[model samples]
Target chain A: MSEFIKPTPMPRKYFTPTVIFLSVIALVGIIFVFARLIFGIGTVTNLSNQYPWGIWIGIDVAAGVALAAGGFTTAALGHIMHKEEYHLITRPALLTAMLGYTFVAMSVAIDLGRYYYIWHPLIMWNGTSVLFEVGICVMIYLTVLYIEFLPIVTERFIGRVNLPGLLKKYNNSVDKFLRALDRGLDKTMFIFIIAGVVLSCLHQSSLGTLMVIAGPKMHPLWQTPILPLLFLLSAISVGLPMVIFESVLTSRSFDLKPETPILAGLGRMIAPILFIYLSFKIGDMVIRQTFVYLTEFNTASVMFVIELVLGIIVPLRLFMSPQIQRSPLGLSIASFLVIFGVFLNRLNNFIVAYTPPYQFTPYFPSVGEIFVTAGFIAIEVLLFRAFVMIFPIVSVPQIPAVHKTKFSIRGAK
Target chain B: MANQSRRNFLKTSALIGAGLTGVSSKPAKAAPNNILDENRMGVLVDTTVCIGCRKCEWACKTAHNLSAQSIESYNDRSVFKNMRRPDDKTLTVVNEYAAKGDDQFPVDVKVQCMHCDKPACVSACIVGAFSKEKNGSVIWNGDRCIGCRYCMVACPFQVPAFEYGKAIQPEVRKCDFCFDRTKDGKLPACVEICPMEVLTYGRREELIDLAHQKISLYPDRYVNNVYGEHEVGGTSWLYLAGRDFHELQFPKLGTNPAPGVSEAIQHGIFAYFVPPIALYALFGGVMWLNKNRKQDEHKEANHE
Candidate 1:
């Protein structure tokens, strides 16, 4: 049997050519974001009154929320279902979710016209609005996510509270505080875990309901009464794939052995979830007789076809293969296709299908818009790297005492 | 008119039944003042009579405190070459459609907020920023608006336009049906300023009668249909067009209210918060059972 590995902070150089490139992109995006705030949204974006939503909403908010489903899905598997073996991946997924939601809130603030009054939804209630439901659930869910992540913070700092010179005297007290926090969080975390799952289900579906009111203005191919159900199903389906995708990428990046067994198990489960989602999606279309639009050869039809066949069908086929599940590259490719499919689905639903009448010009993201979106993504990656470096996120194999000196030398180098 | 009254009665009964069943007990909070008061005001536009003078357009701009050019510039008929929607700069616009098959004069359609009885903006605004007043005016409250622009996406007529140019406190601009003026017992700016007496302002019920009367009297002059009568569960603004409404850039819509399906789904998911609470309990129960089963297995393994 192989030796057990403990979760540990990755020991690696922080700055690389890729990091520098990402920082430059992130910096340009920050400049554009500032321009969007100081100048009007109109200044930095191609968004007109006709198209109030742009890529910030489609990619940053919708896709961001969908991709972050890894946290809850893994939590449900490891904690609720008592699948303790999957615990190795849960922390990274949690961090991803926490960061993803924080960015979602930031993106929302940037997108709002009167961004200062974003808190209005809290004090003033509109139970009837799907947006109200989405807003409230997201606000509550973000809090739950932060609460869920608190234990990780305490875990990292509990016995290692080494304050600097002047504050060194308070290190003992800080350590005591972290210990108490860790104990308290350990008992209360189940409540939060369950809440997170419920909240995710609510808002994920409500996001679909957001477009339902657009009615005839939306393309017939996407407009249906069962949109909320389809959204919830798709989100659930994407969750495991996202976890597998991130896990494989992280292992590859850090030159660690990919957790192929755990990931292969995850891959086995994905086919069924994806199949369920595909069945409902195609079922809805058939029942509504919307498949007729596929023959028309339009942007909406072409996008819908690609999003289904490439994003769902191709990955579903690949994941069903035992050889592919065991192969890291094959699993990564299949997982990526699912992630890309979901991302494209969100973009298509929010931007492509929405064709307002009397539209003088079609909306395409401007240079500034593209930069800001790319910048947000780069910042997420940078933060993820920084997080894993400081926190015990990834698990590494235990080393023997005889080899420890050599390992230490390599880590220092 | 008989059919209209019967539908109204059924609607009222349905609402009362829904309220009695505790499904939508708080109707005021459930929708934005969905009372449907009998005396609610409406405007009837006779497109056959309108000359496309653009007087109402200038008057609307002036009344809304938007800058308007001199009244003489209003005679520029060339502006009608392209269809224009009401935007932040103009709360109302007059668009000209070509006359159908040798008809002498083209039709002039005034584009503005239809102010539906079941207003989608009131139902879609995240912060309850919009309300349907007793005067049948669907108005937006800037103080409550975060300007998320969900209302813009929800409007069946595509009326709400955001002021994207404003960096701060950008307001959603739409026709409030001149709510402020009409509340003080004055006519809407467009209704008062029309030279051809094209726009008629009155109680919604009375206007429907008048619209029907005009349609029956001048069968050859006007289409039999009154746009917005039952479209999207009835709008406060009624239109009498020379031809089919779709030809004049009006979107064809079903009789069901725009927010009906969405609201139903929302309520179903969150009815008394039962489903969510039940889901929470179910998860908690499964977790408890799983934990117990795992402990039992561990104890058995220890014995072994």
Candidate 2:
């Protein structure tokens, strides 16, 4: 059996050509973001009254939230299910979720016409609104994610709070503070872990409910009463795949051996979840008699077919094969397909499936809108790289005790 | 040791569950000002009597303090060559549809917010920035709005319009039923300005009776159906049209209120917050059970 590896900060050089490219893209995106803030959403986005939402909502907010599901799913698997072997991937998943939610919140702020008044939902309650439920849940879940991440911070800094120069005198006091925080968090963590999972389930489904109010305006192929249930299931199904995708990519980027055993185990579990999601999606369509729409060759039907066959069915089949799950390249392909499917599903639900009455022109994202979304993605990638470099996130082969001691001494210095 | 920990976990979870239930059990707060007052007013739009004059458009803009061209400019009928919708700049628009069979004159339809009894905007607003006033006007509160534009998504008639160009303090624009004028005991601007008497302002209940009475009295002149009477669980604005409503660009909608399905799902998911709390407790139980099982297996291995 392969021995377990301890998570350690990657020792690779930080600024590669790819990192520099991503930074440039992120900078361009920031320029557009500022332009949007100054000139209003109308100038930067193709959003009009007929299509008030664009890629900012479909890609940045919806897909961002869906992709972040890896965090809670892993927490549930490793901690809640007591699957000790799976713990190796949990920290990276947590970090991804923390960053994912932070961006989602930021995207929402930028997308809102009155970004400054984003806090109104907290004080002014609307129990009837689906968006209100989603907003409040996301706010609470983001806080929960930050709280769950506290232990990792404490673990890194508890005994290593070496402040520089004038602040060096306070290092001992800071270390003591971190130690106390670590102890307090250790006892209360299980509650938060469970809460995190519960909150994720609530908001993920409620996100589907966001579009439900666009009755008759939405294309029949996507709209159904069980939309919330479908949203929750898809989110659950995508969770492990997202973890696998990020894990494989991280392993490649950092030149570390992939955790094939754990990833294969996760891949095996994904088949059943994807099957459940597929069955419900097809079942809902059939029950609603929406399949008749497939006979008509339109944008909605073609997009629906692509979303189902490519995103869900293909990935489902790929993951079921043990050979595919075990191979690094195969696992990456399968996981990417699943991620692509969820991403496409979000875009389809928010953009393609919506058909407003009196729409003179269909909404297409402006150049600025595309750049802003790309920038957010680039920033996310840059943050992920920076985090893994500084923190003990990715697990690598365990070093011998003597070598480990030497490494620690060098790290401290 | 495992059993002791399990018992302690269960006890703590039960306490948490009880506290959560207490939080959810407080009296349900209904959305403010949704009582549907018995004496609420309405407008009865008699489309058959309306000539293709765009006077209501000019008056609406003037009433809302929007920039309006000379009333003489309204006489230009070429604007109706293309179908138009109520938009940010114009709260109401008049469209002329060709007469169906033998009628000598074309039918003119004035479009604006239908102001449903159970308004979707009132239910869908994230901050409850919209309310159904006692006077039967479904109005938006700009002071409370965060400009999410969800109201635009929820309005069944697609009535609410947003000021997309203005970066600072952009507002949602829609027909407010002339709430400001109504409050001062004045008729709505369009109602006051209609030279044709095509629009009648009165109590909603009385208007519904008057609409049904008009259709019954002039069976040949008007369609048997009264638009908005039962559509979307009934709107405050009733209409009597010569042709089918669909011909006049009115969307065919079910009688169930626009917000019915979404609100039902929202309430069901969050009903008493019981489902989420139950899910939390169930997860706790499973975690405890799994931990105990692992602990037992480890002890057995140690014994070997």
Candidate 3:
């Protein structure tokens, strides 16, 4: 258990062609972001009063928040559900979530016309507004995510809290403080874990509620009173798949043997949750008779069918197969489908399904808008890699015990 | 390119479904506000009387201090070649629908903010940046606006246009029913400038009565429907048109208030704070269950 618990940072070269390429994209994106902030949203986005929200809200904030569900899902599974073996993936998930949310905050700033008043939702409470609820819940959940990550920061520095030169005297004191903080966090960490899961559920569904207010503006195919339920169900369903997807990708990137057995168990969890989600989706469509619109061959109908078939049904079938669940490629593919499905679903809800009354032209995101979104994703990938390289995210417990003995012998000498 | 195949697949899927027809019911209307302000102001636009002069467009810009061409230059019938909406640059636009057979003049409809009684924008604005004033105008405040633009999405009439051209300190521009002028015992800019007396400004209740009286008096001249009286829970601006309102680009909408469905669901789940508390308790129960199991596993390990 100690061997499994004591994670070590991965030893790898930081600068690769992929990293440099991603950095370039991220740099270009940052430039566009500055353009947006300085010249306003109109300059960077194709968004108008006719289509006030575009890909930034749909992809960046909505899809980003959903993809980051791995953190809370793993937290609940490992800490609150006593699935102790799942603990190995929790740290990486937490880091991903922390960075994902940080990106979300930055996206909100970039997306807002009045970026300076981003904090307005914090102080001016409109209890009736779904956006207000989403805002407050996300802010609190972000804080909770950081608090949940403090132990990881503590773990990295606790063992060797050494400082250079004159600050050496305070190193021991800092070490003592970290150790005390780590101990204190362990005792109360479950509270934050539970709070994190609850807060996530609130905002996940509240995001759906944000669209529900658009009412007539939202196409009938996507709009339903059960939208919040569907959003919550989809988020919960996609959680395990995101973890599996990230885990598989992480292993491949680092050239480690994927955690096939643990991930196989996680993969099994996806089908059942997805079944629940599909049932709600199909049932809601039937109940509302939204399926009638499916025959129209329009953009909304086409996208709706794609979201259902490619994103949900195909992934559901793949995940249900026991053999496919165990296979890394199959599991990864299935998980990617689910993630992609949720992303498409958000896009459908925010853009495709939304038809403002007076719009004469269909909205396509501007080049700046696409670049800014791509930049945020690139930034996420870069940060995740850097963090994993520096901190103890992925484990290296399989290292030979002979090195440990040699280290102790050297210390004695 | 891959998207084309996906669309084809969806088309096939759509065709595969048969005999599964079910009709969706209309969205349930939210409870109407019982305390109607009888003295609140409203405008009755008699579209049949409008001459398509576009003078209201000029007057709106001039009164709002927006750039406008000379008032006489507004007589350009060429501008009516395409339909236009009330946008940032133009507060009001007069659209020409070809008049019925043998009629000399085309149906000229003037479009602007409806200023709904139960304004969806007011309800949807997260920061309370919009409000339905006592004068029956749905007004926006730039100071409180965070530029989230949720209100623009929420407006059924889609009247609130943003100053999307501005880089800094952009505003949500809309018809405020001349809120300031109304407060000073003056008519709205467009209402005061109509040479044909196309706009009749008065109390909302009296306007409704007058609209009904006009519709009945000349049933041949009117469609017998007083628009904005019940559409989307009534708007400050009512319309009496000769042809069907839909022919003049009026959206076909239900009588229910626009914010009703969303608010019902949002407020329902969050009512009395029951669900959130219940969810927390459920998480707590799960945590407690896991704690016991963890303890049992620890005890078994200790025994070993």
Candidate 4:
């Protein structure tokens, strides 16, 4: 059982045309990032006082963080909730989260005007500010994520601590050190797993609390007292779908056998979570009497309708079917809808439904801003591919004789 | 060592529990000391008395040490053709709304920061970059500002303007109510320079009373309501407009304090650390329940 669960790096051609295309996009994004840093936020973004947050925030940071919920959800299920079958998906989810959060941090650094003073939130305590809570939690959770990844790092390097020339003598010490570190981490991992779940809850809800501060500035159709709960619930609902989406996509990309039964189990988990989210969403609107605004036939109303109908309702109905849950294509389609829905919900909260009073013009992301956002996602993909090639992230079901020879040649070199 | 560490953890947790209770018990005061002022200063702008002259705009720029076109250049009535807002370059702007039904002189409303009793910008700034001064001016600290512009989003009146043009040291520019001058026991730049004495600068409490008296004295001239007296839980700047304020582009907001709903929910869940601890405990219980099941799975798989 232990041997079967042990992950090994995937075997695939490293430099595919798709990888090259993504690299070009990432390179272009890097150029604009330099422009943003050297010039100003205004130079690269269409963000004004009227629209301080554009897609970089709406898509890259807010939506990025929400989509990364798979990390905690999978960890909680596999390690804490004792769902051992879900263990196979955990490492990949963690890798995605670590990379996703790193980029989220980088995006924030680019977005901030005083990017150098990004650490001020740590020292400056403003408990009342939701952003303060979010900043602190994200900072701490990122550290926890790195700590969680240490065992994986140890696993990769423990026995293969070879060094060239004069450094060869130090290999034995390095190997021993890694083994000790791995042993220590294995015993104490549960504490960090618990903290990760707690920290995730804090920030997910606080992101919603951030929009609540906008108050009358946000359209009534989206505003509610229970926004934090809705945000948390929605994050949880989208968690398993994101895991399934990544797993199915990876399976197709690497030409590995798809874990159909496990993915189908994940599909079942999505329904009840989505149902809870919808109930609260509808209940909040009904109680606040904000449902009337849905009839206004404005941008906010139309956006709300589309967000629920396409993002949640249709996906929820689809996921309930046994046939849809069992097929990789059906699971991917349903999960994509969930991802799109949550992304739209975040976009609605930050940009679509927000109207600054006495504004002359509406805001749209500039070419540079769009490029930078695309670049962040592209970099995440490139990094994910690079790391999986170097480390044992994705499980290799079978190691062919040819592959073993190739691995030994590479190791010897 | 283990016993001492356990005791330490328990002690710290108790202290945190006490502190959280303190925060939730007085949710209104969770806003910070800058929000509370017994005798904060204010301004009452009688728009009915204001002529279309733009001298106050020039004075504000000059007093703030911002570059201004000559005072005479501001007198060009053509500038009022388009309604303008207080931008990064300009701290105050006068917009002329044509009076309803046969009036020659346009209603000129001077616009700037309302400096709410509970300033949302102050509350929203994550790094504590903004604060409501004791003199009732919401001021920005450039060094502390990360330029998240959460303040700009949070402001109901949309007063905070960012320096989008500058590549370096861009600031959130807004009317500071001439806080520096007021600290020196002098009037605000615009209030001191008003030729018609249309701007009355005084304590917030006295100004509200004065606003009501003027509204009653000239019942035919001004609206009965003092625009900013109770809006967004009152503001330092009170307004007496001849027409509805919405006509002048002032956002129609409820009397609720801007941070009320956000703070309530944020404080409610975090209060006494009840929800977080309970959530942790719940997860721990789940871990416990599934512990045996996981071991059983491992054993069964090994047997296979």
- i-RMS, each model, one decimal: 1.5, 1.6, 4.9, 2.4
Clashing pairs in 1: none
| Candidate 3, superposed: residue stretches over 4 Å from native | A164-166, A400-413, B1-36
TM-score, one value per model: 0.94, 0.94, 0.92, 0.93
DockQ (CA atoms), all models = 0.60, 0.52, 0.31, 0.50
Per residue, candidate 4 scores C-alpha lDDT tens digits across A63-136 of: 99999999999989887886666777888999999999999999988888778888887655566777877888
Question: What does each candidate score in C-alpha RMSD?
Answer: 6.0, 7.4, 10.8, 6.1
Q: Which stretches of candidate 1 lie over 4 Å from their true place?
A: A1-3, A400-413, B1-32
Cα lDDT of model 1 by residue, A27-86, tens digit: 999999999999988899999878889999999999999999898888888778867677
Tens-digit lDDT string for candidate 3 (A1-413): 22432456887998989999999999999999988878888888899878988999889998888888888888888777867677777888889899998888888877777888998865444556778778888899999999988887887898788899999999989999998998888788878888899889889998888888787888998998888888888888888888888888888899987878789989988899999999999999988988889989888888999999999999999999988987999999999999999989988988998998888888999999999999999999999999998887885445544332111100001
Expressed as tens digits, the lDDT of each residue in A1-413 for candidate 2 is 22335667876798999999999999999999999999998989999888888889899999999999999899899888978778878889999999999999999999899999999987666778888888989999999999988877787787788899999999999999988888888888888899999999999999999898888989999988888999898898888999999998898898777878788899999999999999999999888999999999988999999999999999999998989988989988999999999999999999998888778899889999999999999999999999898888887767433331111111111
Scored against the native two-chain complex, candidate 3 gets a DockQ of 0.31
The native-contact fractions of the candidates, in order shown, are 0.78, 0.70, 0.63, 0.69
Off by over 4 Å in 2: A1-4, A400-413, B1-30
